[model samples]
Target: MTSPYRVLRSDREDPTVLRRELRRRTFPNPGLAERVRAILQRVETKGDQALVELTAELDRIALTPSELCRTEAPEPPAAPVRKTLRWSLGNVRRFARASRPRDWRMRNREGAWVGERFLPLDRIGVYVPGGTAPLISTAIMTIPFAREAGVREIVAVSPPPIHPVLYYALRIAGATEVYAVGGAQAVAALAYGTESIRPVDKIFGPGNAYVVEAKRQLFGLVAIDLLPGPSEVAVVADEGARAEFVAADLLAQAEHGSSSRILLLTPSAKMLEMVLSRIEEEIETLPRRSMVESVLRDNALFVLTRSLEEALDLVGEFAPEHLSLAVRHPRSAAKRVRHCGAIYLGDYSAVAAGDFLAGPSHTLPTGGSARAFDGLRMDHFFHRTSLVEYTRSAIARVEPKIALFAEIEGLAAHGRSASVRVAGRGRHKENGPFLRGRPPSAKVR
Candidate 1:
């Protein structure tokens, strides 16, 4: 059988070819985009009827409009599982509360009171992928942030056969409602709303290609967190890094699915060889062995770089969803990285920590989107509105500048709006033209 991973030596390969190999295209290839577009349009036109049809056809689960929303309570999880969920929820809640944005007021250059107030979104939908696994932790990672942000309504949706543990976690995380629908249809229902399900102001969480594409297509109609589709991890290892630890992290992400992207960039060829050997040995132990193997065979890359710096440069170009720096000075190495959804430093800092127990939400930008987008955070749940208050004196001071701008733009009414306020100031108002409802001079010039 052919080796699962392909290796490239930077010293031997052409730079142009290496660059082309590292670049990943954004999600929803043309065909996927068209399909997602049709799903969205179907939902928009047919509403609940489309949801039932799509859920039955795609998810293979039959549901009535009423069954779409899960109202009955889920069975409690085992004691050990419940304890773990509570512990994780506590950590996520504390982190979200501490990191949430604060309202502030300050004086501007013109002495006007200007600041921003952060308000929680009225309602939001969190999509938890219920594919091969339950993804129990996604609830803790996503919903509590919205809860801590004070969002009034937090709706959660997962595929049918919703895992009991997942449903319990969503409730503990403060989800106001739970739905049993999934896929592009779930996203469309959340975005456009069905007869049974109301639309939310913003949508959160991550999922498969269809879920991400649905978010992309419905962006203007509803707010979306980010295009956090498949999982991705790039590990930059040095000679000092442990081979077993490096290999374990790579395999951990590979189990996410075949679409996951995994890269191992190392300066030490010996380290590379050891990790490859270790991966082969560990692959046999995982229950999801075939899934991991598929990812390793098609999506994994092992690059031998000239130096650790070169490897870091390659990581920036890749802009992986998860970055692991297993080097002598991982902290220092992390300083040079420009793009990546999240960075895990040192051999001991496993990406799984960030994925499951770590306070940071695992819903991160994937497919090279880290260049522009950030991982999910508490602040994403808030709507920031700028607060501006101008005193009479402050408006008077800036009136001339406003008039100049209006005159330059030929917006006479724009200047008059501001000028009228200043014009009315200090006037005994009974007969003042500014107060008599007369229009201000048409020409500010």
Candidate 2:
């Protein structure tokens, strides 16, 4: 059960060594901007008709808005639903209803009552990925957040892996309009305001490399939640940790794609061995054995450390999307964790628990974004602005000081303005208390 990447020295701290051990680029694709821009232009020129033609040519789904927008569609959870797209439009409605917000106001230190005013974006387009698989949860996680934020006129666009049953989910999720489109073009339709669709102020949700690239390129032109990257997980396990739990977690991330990476850090040689054996044994019977193997070969790393402290140090450096602490006292280990999108504590609470049913947001920072970012929450949908007010007496009290500071900066006009308010007359600029209103060349007695 010994891991192939065990470190003999637990306390080794050479700067170069640490860098080499943990260094990796979670985002590497390039040239996505040019590609996405081209597609956005095409969609803008063609409109709704363009979107239909693109759907048929790129995804093999011939769809019209009437066909794609529906309250309910067929159900093909793990299999093809045939002819029409299969989705749960009602579920989208449920999520939207659950996400609405309440008005808020407050009194500030200045005593002038201030509050925020909330309004919905004029229009928004939903991006549903239907290429490799149908993503019902994607609708739940993303569209609901927008709906809760009071976004109006939400539309949807996606390419059907088969036909176009998936659009039904968009309708259910509070989408007023829907389109059968996918890839960069879908992003384009949302960004550039194609004849069929209006350009939006922002774009949301995660997608493939091409889609992610499009988002990145258009960041300045439009707002985005966060950049999507390869899936990643890091497991911190103690001697008592279960090998089955550790192996299953690695496999779950592995199934994301060949690019996805998983890491295991443990203080127990015996535990590491058990996990390795379990991984090898389970892969043969895995539903996606080929994917598991390919991921392990391309981006996997298994580390055996001398103690839990060393494991903790390495885990923080990676800042994985999902982190599971399977130690004797999982809570104790969690206190040391400074970085991780989500943490699954204890053997009973595995990564899978947080993936689906956990009340916390599943959309989290990936790559090394955990270093400065947090998982998506209701706050992500809101923006903050400050209100400040000062009394006229307050200005009078500080005018003398303000005048002196302005004179020091050689802004004669600024000092005049500062005193002008104090005088309540023409040119109410404050006289410099330090200079007693004398010119710099004039003597102060």
Which model scores highest in lDDT? 1
Alpha-carbon shift of residue 137 in model 2 (angstroms): 1.6
Give model 2's clash tally: 22
lDDT of each: 0.89, 0.68
lDDT of 2: 0.68
* CA shift of 149, model 2, Å: 2.8
Q: List runs of model 1 lying over 4 Å from the truth.
A: 1-4, 426-445
Summarize candidate 1's per-residue lDDT along 1-445 as a digit string, tens digits. 1355898899999988898778776746899989999998999899999989998899888988888888887788999999988988888888898899977665667766666778999999999988669899999999999999999999999999898889899888899999998999899999999898899999998888888888988899999899887898999999999999999999999998888989999999999999999999999999999999999989999999999999999899999999999999988999999999999999899999988877888888888889899999988999999877777777889999999999999999999989998878564323222112333333222
- As for candidate 1, its clashing pairs are none
